[model samples]
Target: MTRILIVGGGYVGMNVALRLQRRLRHHAEITILDADSYMTYQPFLPEAAAGNLEPRHLVVPLRQVLHRCRMLNGWVVGVDSERRTVRFRPHQGEGYDLPYDLLVYAPGSVSRLLPVPGLAECGIGFKTVEEAIHLRNHVLAQLDLASSTRDEAIRRRALTFVFVGAGFAGVEALAELEDMAKDACRYFPAVDAADMRWILVEATGRILPEVGPEMGAWTLEQLRRRGIDVRLDTRVRSAENGRVVLDDGDEFDTDTLVWTAGVRPHPLVRATDLPRDDKDRVKVTPHLTVVGRPEVFAAGDSAAVPDLTRPGELCAPNAQHAVRQARTIADNIVARLRGRPLREYRHAYAGSVASLGLHKGVAQVYGVKLRGPLAWLTHRSYHLTRIPTVNRKVRVLVDWTLALFFPRDIVSLGALAEPRKEFEFAAGAPDGAKTGTQDGTETTVPRPAGARF
Candidate 1:
C-alpha cells in the first residue's frame, strides 16, 4: 500500500486527505500532520469575532472528519523531498522524521508581519479562531473600561479602535466588530456609539479590491456613512505603547490595534528544498503537482499554482480556489496511483462576497453585483453552503436564527483568559491576609492598558 503523508490540516490538506482517504481506502495508508487537530473555517471568522456565531462552530475537528487517516499533532519543522522525510516536533517529547511515498505539502499561510516598532508587542492578528473570540472579548472589555473609567485620556484611548489592512479579513472584521460595539453601547449608559472611534487605515487606494472597484467604492461609502474613518493611502508608521502614528502624519492613542495586513506562505515552505516562487510559495503546475516532483502535491495558500484562466498569473490565495484545488489534487493523486492521466487544476475567478455587518454587505458574482441586505443574505447563504459538515451548518444556521429574535451577546468573558487565577489564589494563598499587600490593603491588580487576549 502507498503511504500518503499530508503536512497540513488546513483547507487544502484536510479536504485532500478527506477525499483521498475515501477514494483509496484499503488501498493506501494516509496520514495528516498538523500543529492543531482542528481546521478553521476562516470565512466565518469575522462573524465569530462579532458574536454572530460561536467560535467553536467555526472550526471542524480533523479527527472527526478524517477518521480513516492517521492524525499526527505536530509542527512541520522541515521537509526533505530528496529523502522523502518530514521533520516534525510535537507538543512534547523529541522530534522525529516521518517518511512517506507521496507528499502533500500544503502548510497554509501565516500572518505577514512587518518589522514595525512595537507592532510585535502591541498588535494582534485575526486569522485563527482563538484570535477571533479573544478579539470579541477584548473589544467588549474595552467598552467596559471606557464606560467605567473617569480619566478622559483613558476613556478616549479605550474607545479608539484601529485596524490596518482593507482586505476581506480586515474590512469584514472591522465592520462586524464596529457594528457589535455600537449595538453594545446601548447597554453601557456612559458610552455611546459616537464616542467610539473606529478607524480603518489602508495603505492602498481602495478597500475590498476582491470585489470590483464599483462595489469596493460602494462598501467604502457605506462604511464612511456609519462614521467609520476610512483612511486610504495611509500606513501605520508606529504603534509604540498603543500610540498609533500614521504615515499621513496623523497620530492617535488607541487600546486596540488589529493587524490583518495579509498572509504569506508558511515558513515551512522556505525551510524545504522544494522549488518555490519569488513569493516563497511552492511552485506547482496546472495539475497541482510540484515542479519536477511528480510524487509531491501542493495547493492552497502555500502552492503557487498557475492560473490557467489568466496566463502569467497564479491563483489567488483564497478559500474559493483552495477548496476547488484540493479536489483536483486529490483526483490527480488517485489517478497517478491507478496509472491514469492526471487532470489539470483550472478554475475561473468566481466573484467575491463580503459582509459589512448584520443585514449589510457587498457582492459581485459572475458580473452580477449586489449590495445591502440582499448581498448580506447572499454572503451568508454562500458560506453556509460551503462550510464543511452538516453539523456545523445546522449550528451556524441556528445561531443566525437566534440572532433575528434576540440581541447579539455583548457580554465579555474576559476571565476566560485567566481561568486559573482564582484557582491559583485559592491553592497558593489559603489565607486572605497572605493575598493582601504589605499595608494590609487588598492587592488590586492594575487592568491591562491594551488588549490582553
Candidate 2:
C-alpha cells in the first residue's frame, strides 16, 4: 500500500486528509501528523474570545474527524523530501524518522514578529485559543483592577488597552472584546465604559486592507465614531516597561498590549530543504506541487500557490482559498491514482465580510455592498455555512440564537488560568483559614489591588 503522510492539522491538511480517506480507501494508507489534536476554526476565534461562542465548539478533534486515517499527535521537525523521510517528535515520545511514498506538507503560519525590544517578554499575540482565553481573562481582570483601585496611576494604566494591527484578526478581536467590556461594565458598579481606553495603532494608512478602500474608510470612521482611538500612519517604537511609545512621539502607559501584527510561514518551513519564495513560503506550482518535486504537495499559508485567476498573483492566505485548494488537491489525488490528468486550480476573487461587534458589520459580497445589522447577519450566515461539522454548526447557531434573548456573557472565569490556585491555597491554609492569597505568586490575570469585601 502507498503510505501517504500529511503534515499540519489546519484547514488545508485536515480537509484534504478527510476527503482523501473516503476517495482512496483500500488503495492507500493515510497518516496525519500535527502538533495539536484539534483543528481550530479560525473564523470563529473572535466570537470565541468575546464569549459569544464556546471555545470547544470552534475546534474539531482530528481523531474524531479523521477516523479512517491514522493520527499522530506530533511536531514535524524536518522533511527530507529527496529521501521521502519525515523526522518528527511525537508528543511525549522519542524523535524518529518515518518513511513515506507521498508527502502532503500543509504546515501553517506563525505570528510574524519583529525584533522590537521587550515585545517578546510583554506583548501577546491573538492567534491561538490559549491567547484568546488569556486576553479575555486579562481584559476582565484589568477592569476589576480599575474598578477597585484607589491609585489613579494604576487605574489609568489598567483601563488602557492597546492593539498593534488593523487586519481582520486585530479588528474583530478588538471590536468583540470592546463590546464585551462595554456590556460587562454594567455589572461593575465602579467601572464605566468611558473609563476604558481602546487604542488601535496601525502603521499603515488604513485598516481592513482585504476590504476595498471605500469600505476600509467606512470601517475607520465607524471605529472613531465608537470612541476608538484609531491612530493611522503610526508605528510602535517600543512597548518596553509598560510604556507604549509610538513613532509620532506619543507615549502612554498601558498594562494590556496585544500584538496581532500578522503571521509568516511556519518556522519549520525554514528548517526544511525546500525552495521557498522571497516571503519564505514554499514555492509551489499552480497545481499546488512543490517545484521540481512532483510527489510532494503543499497549500495554505505555508505554500505560495500561483493564482491562475489573477496573473502574477499568489493566492491569499485565507480560509476561502485554503478550503477550496484542499478540495481541489483531494480530487486531483484521486485522479492521479486512476491515471487521469491533473487539473489546474483557479478561482475568482470573492468579496470580504467583517463583523464590527454585536449587530454591526460591513461586507462586499459578489459586488453587493452591505453595512450595519444586515451586513452583520450576512457575516454570521456566511460563516455559519462554512465553519465545518454539523455538531459545531448546530452549536454555533444555537449560541447566536440564544444571544438574541439573553445579553452577552461577559463574566470572566479568570481562575481558568490558575485552576490549582484554590487547591494549592487550601493545602497551605493558615491557622484561621483566611480567604486571601497567602502566597505572593502573581498570576497571569492579576486581580484588583484592594480589599475584596
Candidate with maximal TM-score:
1
How does each model score on TM-score?
0.96, 0.94
What does candidate 2's lDDT look like per residue over 280-334, in tens digits? 9999888778898888888999999999988999999988999999998888777
- Per-model CA lDDT versus the true structure: 0.92, 0.87
- Model 2 scores worst on lDDT over the 10 consecutive residues at 444-453
- Which pairs of residues collide in model 2? none
lDDT of 1 by residue, 304-323 (tens): 98999999999999999999
Ten residues in a row with the worst lDDT in model 1? 444-453
Model 2, residue 330: what's the lDDT?
A: 86
Top of the candidates by lDDT: 1
Q: Tell me how far candidate 1 lies from the true structure as C-alpha RMSD in angstroms.
A: 2.5
